[model samples]
Target: MTAFTRGFRLHLADGQVLDGAEFPSGRAALVDDPEFGFVTGAVSVEELLLGYHGARIEWDDEALLEGKPRPTADSITSDQLDALLLKAARADSTWATALREAATVADGGRENDCGCGGCDTCAQHRIGLELRRRADERDGGRP
Candidate 1:
């Protein structure tokens, strides 16, 4: 039970909710739910609207169980940076070559009990798949 400096109840798009928090104590377990996987840092409503990770955030209100809420970040996260890299891969000169050599293979949609597009498995999962695709290409189809 690490003391969290801030907390929030995340309302997913499909009626599921995930509660989380940041540990200024440097050891908050609340933010890393086994069900929701791992969520680090703070995100604002504006950034959530971008669907950058395929999930919308409830920005109208917040549920802090401990500390004050911080505003949206002034910079992008490393995951966001990776997403940008993947996006850039789309426009790269070798895209056509890579596509022919290693075209995408869909995972047949969500492979979970809740596939309504709200759970971390559904929302954050897309980012993982996309990143994996990028990785496969970068690794010359080794994966």
Candidate 2:
């Protein structure tokens, strides 16, 4: 187990501990549960994390294992970056487009994911998606 797996942890930025009624580590796993699929589609991870931290877990859910706490904002940022990368590796152009658009908007005198502060990888994801989209369009709608 990594150091993070031992127990409670905090994100480096704000040092908020997601443990002991403050927040829970199982949020990620819970988010994947089919029972909450409807809510998952409607809410973003950031929003869900903020809104549901410390929220009670229904005891009946077998996947609801109380694990570690939430990490810090910095840790979240890192995770977000990783998520972006994973999305890219999986060829998820929607996220790629969104991230690139975010970067472009940030560069073009618009507010970005103020919380995320934009990233080069996001820009790259956007560019890749755009290129692919254009290629598909040029090929008469076949990727």
Overall lDDT per candidate, in order of appearance: 0.46, 0.40
Q: Write the per-residue lDDT of candidate 2 for residues 1-108, one digit (tens) a residue.
A: 112322222232344333211123333322333345532322223444465545433222112223333334445466555755565555655544555455455445
The TM-score that candidate 2 achieves is 0.17
TM-score of each: 0.23, 0.17
lDDT for residue 88 in candidate 1, whole number 0-100? 62
Residue-wise C-alpha lDDT for candidate 1, range 108-134, written one tens digit per residue: 434333355565556445544665567
- Report the Cα lDDT for residue 43, model 2: 29
Residue runs of model 2 more than 4 Å from their true location after superposition: 1-70, 77-80, 88-143
